[model samples]
Target: MGWRRSRSSEPHADLRLLIERFGWAVEHVRVPRRSTGTPSSYTVGLTAAGHPEIVVLGLPAPVAQDFLNAVAEQVRAGGSYRPGQRTGEFTDEDGPVVFLRVEDTGGLASARDVYGSVEALQLVWPDSTGRLPWQPGYRNAPGVQPLLGQVP
Candidate 1:
């Protein structure tokens, strides 16, 4: 299917298109919020069982990598994440899952750039879980660490 664009008044059209392109059904698109550099902050809601959500925050170029790495490590280790006071427990009945946080230029967003960011997230889709959503059968077969090597 081709990329779907939201109405002119709607925001995060590119993010919506990218999320859909990844094959994960989009459940909701929260209204964009005001940001410093970009016109608005975007969040793409997913229909996954665990209520997964993806938000592209407007962070400075320098700390973006560190932030991504820190979040990845936290999620991998099953620790409480301080981002907005939400615990970083990435999991559901299927197994542990991660919320893909991608960094992008704090400049104006374009369909091309959003697509690129989504692509980057796919490269690390499962984070440290080492399992995809479709691999639940295999993941539960035997000798599998459901929580990506972390207990509970």
Candidate 2:
């Protein structure tokens, strides 16, 4: 499927696609605010259990990677990562889910709280220019995917 053109419009539509494809849910209400940038991103409760995960600060891959790498470095220094859970809106409803986080990014003080710190990593994947677009209608976009009725 294609990416969304503008997250502000029909943001949930793109989020739904992400859930269907990436198994990640984006909560509309919990979207972070008061960011250092426009079209900002807040910590998306990466996990269904709300244990803290990746920071969803609207940013491109390179910039996000920098934040991630920095946090990763912090993790390597003495933190850790795990399959943690966080509470969030799933398919527009509350539910449990999972995602990956740095475990810690605030240096030694938060070393033990790697997962929480991971929530604080402050990374994001933003497309401010609407450079990409969610399929005009996902139904029209076709590609390799779950095969038709093969008996689950």
Candidate 3:
């Protein structure tokens, strides 16, 4: 009954969905032209409200293009991260965006999973000593379904 996603149709679909649901002011920065050869990598940026930029670097041309598309989609959808939500905020304005970093892992296999079992949930604050925080388990609402799984 709530926002359940079947499997994602393409690579990075889930990431794009996350960005679409949670980012503000997403953009693609073009690589400078090189006379002798074409640029091999691209950069994509996403900024949530009250947070610094989250940059994805060294993306392949196709993926970079997809990032651009994701930006457009986010804009059209008017998506934004809400303040006070666990996964939404950074430790500070300059704190890390805590991306899934698709390039580091292989890719998103299904809509339900990220890098095996790592689902991007609300971000909890670090301990008093300043250690990095990790993602918490996600729960579906009573009348809502996750995009990946069926409700019983």
Candidate 4:
């Protein structure tokens, strides 16, 4: 069970469990924010009990604010693209935030099932206070779960 995570994301308790359970290789999970340009979406990968789950991680207060700011700029400028993927006048420091996507064999539905077990695992954050850092995901988003029924 091994996977990757982005360096800049963060995760909550339940999310952490799903990450560990699935053995995702990503460094972190990307949180969603209201984007003015293109419709913004986020996701995470999971593999619980040899299955995968795509639980959409929630946006933290600080992270969400940053994304919203970028969205505003894009809307006013008539731009399109996510803050992390876009640039020029309207861009967020947001890096390549890891997103849950469909795998070859399992697709994404299997990942969703893994998240369903998150509650039972009682996942814990790497930090004692459980407060995600500015870069986040590393301590929190690394284990965050994605919403899989549909990438809302």
Candidates 2 and 4 compared by TM-score, better number: 2
- C-alpha root-mean-square deviation, each candidate: 15.8, 17.4, 17.8, 17.3
Clashes of each: 0, 18, 11, 37
Q: How many backbone collisions does model 1 have?
A: 0
For candidate 3, the TM-score is: 0.23
Q: If candidate 1 were superposed on the true structure by all CA atoms, what would the RMSD be?
A: 15.8
Scanning candidate 2 in windows of ten residues, the lowest lDDT window is: 143-152
Q: Weakest 10 consecutive residues, lDDT, candidate 3?
A: 143-152
Candidate 1 stretches with Cα past 4 Å from truth are 1-56, 82-152
lDDT of 1 by residue, 1-152 (tens): 22223455544655455455643212122234552232122223222212222332323322333333344344335533321232334333333434332334232234234343331121112323455433553433232212211112
Model 2 per-residue lDDT at 99 = 31
Across 1-152, the per-residue lDDT of candidate 2 in tens digits comes to 22212355765555545545533332222224554333322222233333343443334434443444443343435543444333222212332222334444442222223233334332312123321123232232122111111111
Runs of candidate 3 exceeding 4 Å displacement: 1-54, 81-152
